[model samples]
Target chain A: MEAFLKYFDLLELSQEAGIEDVRKNYDYLKNLYSGDSIEIAALNTDFSPELRQEYLARLDDAHEKLTQLLENKKPAVAQNTVRMDDELCDWIANIACFSGAALKSIRERMVVDLKDMFTTTRIQLQYLEDIENEVFESFRAEVYLRSYLVEYTRFLSLDTPRVLADYLPRYRAWAASRTTPAGMPHL
Target chain B: MIWAIGGGKGGTGKSFITSSMGTYLAQKGRKTILLDADLGGANLHTFFGLTRPRYSLTDFFDKKVALQDISVQSGIANLDLITGSIGSLDSESINHGQKQKLFRHIRALDADHIIIDLGAGTHINTLDTFLLADRMIVVTAPEVTALENMYHFIKSAYFRKLKFIFKAYDLTTSIQETWKNRATYDIHNLKDLIIHLKQSSDRVRDIFDREMSGFVVHIVLNQVRTPRDILVGENLKSVCMNFLGLPVVYAGYARFDEAVLKNINSKEPFMLSNRLSPVATEIKALAENIIAGTHISVRKDVANGSLS
Candidate 1:
């Protein structure tokens, strides 16, 4: 599933499509290649039946994937974002900064443990530091950032997509402060 | 190999699967012939876009035509179809002896593969023909009603098989009466029947053990929509195995495609017209599996493609 996420672009599906949208797209593409499919007749005059079957199978395979995206399918409402409460965010910071417990003593230690638990999950030290510091600026690509936060928070045993949902608005507000009211591009 | 396609439920696409499978086998260079076993409601020829032929099973019966004479060419190379009787009460009301004679002739067909599409309903004619086939497939759509009807179909086929097995016993008549008389002792389903057989004489139990060990049934799920629907065949196989002790093959599934309707209305063969569709791919895979006799998940010997 993690590897197949790369196919979102290939399937013409947004990284953010809900389960229902995903299902609808799958059906639409499936019908487009069916025996009496008008789409094929109209679009590809020299369409190879073998190629059509292969593409349809790949589309089915892509749609068959659930991954963690389906978990985040429902875009969280403002009140629905996971609440960290000042204390947990402070604790995430404090654990990386000053916790006396051996396992939670450092962000690197926590990351190592999380990496071991989720063997396939890829994480960089910079991303780990940004997550711990609550500095959401560097990871402005909303989709990847939301996905990363969802995983990191889940590893820390947080409320999962809900917490990431809560953090998104804050990130947007912080990003807004750096730009002018005219919405000009700025670092 | 004679493969009988029957599911007690109506509108489960048995004819569609039969026609597609027949076409696929023929395309694979196998000598394949399809029979319309649905006496009263026969329509397998329509899937091949064949509404009428010069000769049909009716002509064989009424005109005293030879069975070979009625084996009409189905257009596809190596494939012939004996068109079904169109609403003939004579075929429907065939006596047991006449039905047996017809089945014997069907079995003698000079083809490598014979796929007979039986009509909906668990009538004795349907069950007997289904049970007589070298291979049997039960088709069901992924709906609660279809699944329920499939269960009933399996049970009926199983009971018919048991009836055949028990006929060998000298005390067959008494055994059947006693087995069915639940008032004397509660025997609930196929499992109970097996348990009842166990308490009988060693010879009766041994005969049953031998015959049933050879019986295998295959299942195909059709018009599946959701991912969960794909598992219905396996789930049905599991239930039958656990409850009835029958070996069921989960051949594969056909995704629901609207083109099925369009093809039907246009009178185009599905696999030929929609060569690249998922339904076509699945049907082809199903044909391969049936040919390989891997439908039995266990290590049972392939029945040599003869259920008899």
Candidate 2:
């Protein structure tokens, strides 16, 4: 832990800082030392070129090490999630009907695990699986399902209003098909 | 709190910032005193639209005038000014005993805050007054000349502080001897000198580390014209920490505004006339940051040149 903290110190961040914080500070420090700004030029008398190179090298090492450390510490399922390509993003945007299977397929194509979704959204794991499977009976009421869907879509950085507009109707259709209306379950 | 504003170069807005901050503090209901300690060229009174005062620091030093007696009201409520003598008692002439006495009297003044506007250059008198402040602030522009002088000033102040520590311990000769043969000791910079001294004895190491930790200098970037210019403060802080091993607080920055020059030329208190201007807002933020012992946090996007 002490050794790990030294990396945070190098980036001028606290140990509890998030991965975003680490990346931001890393980019900042890297840009600062790599360039020949007046600030660096003014210190030429004290900081030689060789010394600056060493400092930059140390910064790179610290950034690389911290990224790996933070990556490993993330919930197992999120470790493999890659940046969304434009094509994938376009496809997700063109998703006219957000069915449970479609949402599951989108998650799969993005390499996002259900457990990671659960970890981030903090929705019950069983309920998340149920929602992905379109198990309408599993949800006690429409409100719970709608709220969970909102959280899940937001976590995935999708357009919440559009996703809700497409997906909630299907759940309502399922509720109407049942003999009894989907009302709040008794506590 | 006593805040001393000095950068090693002239015409970088030191007096402007000093007078502006003093005005802001006084307007905020703090009993603030503005002491123009730029003895060689004291014109902070001009920033407040005031003519030359009847008394100045010359009265305090040449004759035995109390600092309070010499402090003339700045026409603005809750703010007072102590103008430095023009062409009298150049910084070089003020001996160590006089400097000590001035510092003692400054600390004894009854006010919420005393902001001192120091003259340019790395003169020992200027540095000692800067070091005397609870908050030592260095102001600089984006230009290379201003930056170079700022670095020189900060380095001189750091060395002075180190020498003071050694002198307190009666080890001035030891430090002088080591510095005299710096090549042999591999003391290429302040940090290197510190390392060499720390290896000498545990007592010296403790005193050095303790003093270094307490010796923090705040940086204020003036006349910032672009987002890129804002990053200069953070850049200075980074270099000071990494190379000089000095703790620097990037207090904040004031953007370049033509209105500022207009205000100064007209001898109007810029803060009073342009209270809602961007520069005034920045100065207020900087003053608050200084008082809170916090600094402006440069966003990473700004550092990466992503935010214009």
Candidate 3:
């Protein structure tokens, strides 16, 4: 852990920083020292070229090590959840049709949470829940429902066009069932 | 708080910034004292349109007069001026004892802020006085010569500080000897020297890590003409941190305005006359940054050749 933290100290970042922060700071510091601007020119006598090269090498090493460390540490839960099983894939492939309940079953088998999906996709939590529960009335229009489904399927790493092909027909059938036949639905 | 403003090269607006910032602080109701510590070639009094005060640092040194007595009213509210004695005392003439005494009395002076305007060049006296400040500020212009000298000044100050630490540790001779034969140890810069010393023992490393944490210098870029020029401050900060392992705060920058020179010539207090001006706003922001122990955030847009 001490060795791991030294990289963060070199980049002047905290241990809690994400990979993006590490990359940004590394790029900034690298660009800064690599330049031959007047600031560096002034140090010509003292900060020899060899010394600067050595410093740059250290920066490269730190950046590489920090990137690897953070990448390995970042998605421990996500990594475990993303391991696809052959049985699950076969089950998904053999399904006769796609439905909200099928999508919910796949997500639960992978231990993916609705809140995590909302956080990553930035789709509203209520809308995501509505999509999973097949609350078709909550959607304002067919286009909204289609776009939301596409986004939701993409978030789950599902085949988007195929899922849409299977899901849209079901939604259309439900819509047709809800419509009245020639003013017979006044009740 | 005590603020020392110095840049190695002259004519980079060190005194101008000192006077303007002092005036600004005083106008903001802080009892400020402006010390013209440029022992040779002092002219900060002229910025305020004051005639050479009868008693200067000369009295304080030769006559043993108190610093409070040497201070004369700056013709502005809540501001006092201690004019430097021209040609009477150069950096060389002031002994170590005298420098220590001056530093002691400077700290003892009662004021909300004592802004010391130091002379150009990395004189030991100047460096020591600059190190004495609660806030150490370096002012520089955008030109190459100014930037180069600014780096020299900061490097000298950092070395002087390291020497001070080494002296406290009773390893002064060790540093001098190592620096004398630095090539043998493959020490190229101060950072390398520090690393080499740390390898000598754990005690030196601990002392260095503890003592060096407080040695932060604030940079103020003056006379910036273009949008590109403002990025110099950020660049300087980066170089200092990366190359010297020194933490530098880019306090802020002031744009180049001919009116600044005109104000100095006319002896008009620029801060008061141009309080609403952009330069004044920049100076005020920098002063507040220094007071608040904060720095400005500069973003570089390489594609646009501009900064925001």
**Cα shift from native, residue B287, model 1 (Å):** 1.1
lDDT for model 3, on a 0 to 1 scale?
A: 0.83
Per-residue lDDT tens digits for candidate 1, residues B1-308, read: 98999988989899889988998889889999998878787777777778777787777666877787788888899999988777874345778887877888998889999998988888888899998888888888877677667777887888887777667666577776876796577775557667676776566666666777658878888887765566556555544653456778887777788999899878778888888887888898888887676652322122133211
| Candidate 2: segments with Cα more than 4 A from true spot | A1-6, A15-22, A73-187, B173-187, B199-201, B303-308
| Alpha-carbon shift of residue A101 in model 1 (angstroms) | 50
| lDDT per residue as tens, model 3, B154-212 | 88999899878888899998788999999999887777888899888777878887888
Kindly report which residue stretches of model 3 are placed more than 4 angstroms away from their true locations once superposed: A1-12, A58-187, B173-186, B302-308
Per-residue lDDT of model 2, residues B1-308, tens digit only: 99999999999999999999999999999999999999899999999888879899999998999988999999999999999977876998888899999999999999999999999998999998999999999999998899989988998998888778878889989778888999997778768878888888877877776677768888999999889889888788777887878889999999999999999999999999998898999999999999887989876465344223
Question: lDDT by residue for model 2 over A1-187, one digit each (tens)?
Answer: 2355678889988765767888988888888878888888777667687887888888888888777655523324554334789999999988878888888888889888887787766678898888789999886556567667876776676777798888888887988787555643221
**Model 1 vs. true fold: TM:** 0.58
Docking class of 3: incorrect
| Residue pairs in candidate 1 whose N, alpha carbon or C atoms collide under 3 angstroms | A81-A162, A81-A166, A82-A162, A82-A163, B134-B306, B134-B307
Worst 10 residues of 1 chain B by lDDT: B299-308
Go through the candidates in order and give the clash count of each.
6, 0, 0
Give the TM-scores of the predictions, in the order they appear: 0.58, 0.73, 0.73
Each candidate's lDDT (Cα)?
Answer: 0.69, 0.85, 0.83
